[model samples]
Target: MMKRPFGIAVAQLGPIQPSDSRASAVARLVEMMREAASLGARMVVFPELALTTFFPRYWMSDEDAIERYFEKSMPSAQTQILFDTSKNLGIGFYLGYAELTTDGHRFNTSILVDQTGKIVGRYRKIHLPGHADHKVGKPFQHLEKKYFEVGNEGFHVWQTMDARIGMCLCNDRRWTETWRVLALQGADIVAVGYNTPSVNIHWPEPPHLRMHSHLISLQAAAYQNTTWIAAAGKAGLEDGCHLFAGSVIVSPAGEILAQTQSEDDEVIYCKADLALADTFRQHIFNYGAHRRPEHYRLITERTGVGDPLGKEPDPS
Candidate 1:
């Protein structure tokens, strides 16, 4: 069979300080987009909350956060340059930002822009991590649950750039069900953006395990679902808190084809053979051939671990 190759890039961004203006951040993104185009990439993926500092780290009023960090419109005055450049370079991009709706709903969102600079798809983050209450003694807060509402739109894939593309943001990538839903929809490539802290605020987790879990999640997802994955991260120190950088592009065969070497603004590209997934999709990972959905009802029926299904209750 002939190879169906696609060129993709992951643009890893450095920290955006709390005082940094949106204009400055967009300029950095435009620079990386140009570099990715020059390197022969058809599309690029940027990290979560790329427009501002990771504000969820601080506890603030919802109204204040929305006014300071959320975007009312995608191509507003500050972000128009990204679309213009995309159209000029004929390169598509995936960007993550805070989206405030006209109806007053806020979401941690990511949009998929085509070569024409038009947004073809959008994904709101569903699996919001962290607590709504302020952790009094912790160095930083993870207030995603408090600031943003749960995503309403379900996982979806779009046909563009001659391939099926799906998107998920931050913590969503850690869930297997997220990958399975997209793969079931025939997704060829999955784009993920994240802003993860280097330290665990809830427990004394070894810092190294953060990077390890990030990489392993993508590798396992790619191989199991037989889809290409491009993950971008906002790394390095921001306001004294550090985020690890291991942005990577994983092939369907569970291999890291490319990875960012620096914890700064970097672009890593790979020309992947899209057809390579067919070998596994048609055999080992073939959902239609082997999946037993009937027996997996517990996944959606309950939120936490419980007694074994069909097991008899112990006599009192």
Candidate 2:
């Protein structure tokens, strides 16, 4: 069987200011969708927390104020325009947002909508980064651990028209298990979105180094998993935080196929031959023949949870 090429667009957003209304943000996303369609892309991917500013950075004492940041309904009237636009253009998309389920649970979630604009799959971020409570000494706050619950559902992959796809959010990309789990389920392409501040509040490093770290992580994951990776970022400075713009599409061979040039709202596309994954997946990366899960029970037994202060693992 011959495999077809899938054109993917990675949309890097600058930032959604706290003052920007949801409608205005959707309008911007709509424009990007049109741009990607014009570029011959069949799917477009946006960064995590795309609809609003990265609210996790700020700690709100008022519960109502915190809830205000979450969307009660996924395709709320404000976001319906995005679905309508995608349907009109016949392009599918992966979008990340703050989800407030009717059951009263809040999650950092992302959804996969087919070309018809019908949502086919949904994923909640599992590895919630940052501290649960506000730290007084940190220059700024990273309270995602406080705002969103740890996702309960496990990693999942969806069978789409073009390829087998998977979704993961910001910090999840840093964990090797995130990609491995998806690969084990036969994912050919994984789309990840991130809203990362340039400064590591827990421990500060050079801004350029932080950006380099982002690319390295993406490339390594692509090669290790033998899958295509489309990673989008919320770039530019948001409020007082500076985010690195390195949104890129990586091939199964770990080559960067396309990337955004600016730290702003930009759309870049690449036509990936989905079959390319077979070159590696059936060879050096063949999990069925190479993986020995029974011997890896230690990984499952040890959750690897650590204290926020970076405590060394007990060498017991």
Candidate 3:
């Protein structure tokens, strides 16, 4: 059986400040959808924490302010317009955001919606970074751990139009567990969105090739997993803070098929053959045929509640 090829857009966005309302931020998303839809892209990938600036840095003494940034649910009154636009345009998308769960846990998350404007799946970022407290003496900004709890759920995959779609966010990509979990589950494409700040005060100023290295990480993960990948970014200096912007679409062979420029805002468009993805999966990089899960039994495992895979393993 032959599968049809599809195209996706990595609509790398510029920075949105704390003042940018959901209505306004979503308006920008809508424009990308319309443009991508016109270009025949079945799906579009937006940046991590796309609805607002990366606000986890500032600790809110007043908790009510959390409601303003975190979406109670997808397509809240402020976001309904973007959902409506997707329905009217007939394209699917994966949107990243800060989510407040009913249990009072905050998560870094993303959702997958099909062309008909229905949410098919959801994934939360597993890697929680930065220190919890805002230490005045500790170099730069610190507070994500203070604001958002570490996501307990792991990676996930969804069946869509004969392609296995998967989602992971910024820090999640730095870890191999997220990609491996999805790869084992038969994901054909992995979508990642990030807002990587330029100030790595901990280290010397990184050279320009770092963006290329970032793409390599995504590409290598795709190759090792035999999956196509679309990684988008929130680029440019947002209110004086600069972020690295190098959105990319990579083939399963770890090749850069399409990529955005190194600065400001841009989008990368690439046609991906779902069948070719299978070719890679079946050939050299076949994940299932070659992976050895039993060997990892050396690592002691424990059980825990609320585990995504089942009540089975303790998150080490």
| TM-scores for every predicted model | 0.96, 0.94, 0.89
lDDT of 3 by residue, 6-110 (tens): 888888888887787877788888888888888888899999989898776565652854766777777688888777877888888989998888777788888
Best by TM-score: 1
Residue 132 of model 1, lDDT score: 93
| Candidate number with the higher lDDT (2 or 3) | 2
RMSD (CA, Å), candidate 3 to true, equals: 4.4
Better of 1 and 3 by lDDT: 1
> Which model is ahead, 1 or 2, in terms of lDDT?
1
For candidate 3, the per-residue lDDT at 23 reads 74
Q: After superposition, how far is residue 144 of candidate 2 from its true place, in Å?
A: 0.4
Could you tell me which residue pairs clash in candidate 3? none
Shift in Å, residue 143, candidate 2: 0.4
Which ranges in model 3 have alpha carbons more than 4 Å from their true place?
Answer: 1-3, 62-65, 137-142, 205-212, 298-316
Residue-level error in angstroms, candidate 1, position 275: 0.7
Compared with the true structure, all predictions reach lDDT values of: 0.94, 0.88, 0.79
The alpha-carbon RMSD values of the candidates against the true structure, listed in the order shown, are 3.5, 3.0, 4.4
Prediction 3 global C-alpha lDDT:
0.79
Q: What global local distance difference test value does model 1 have?
A: 0.94
What is candidate 2's local distance difference test score?
Answer: 0.88
In candidate 1, how many Å is residue 126 off?
A: 0.3
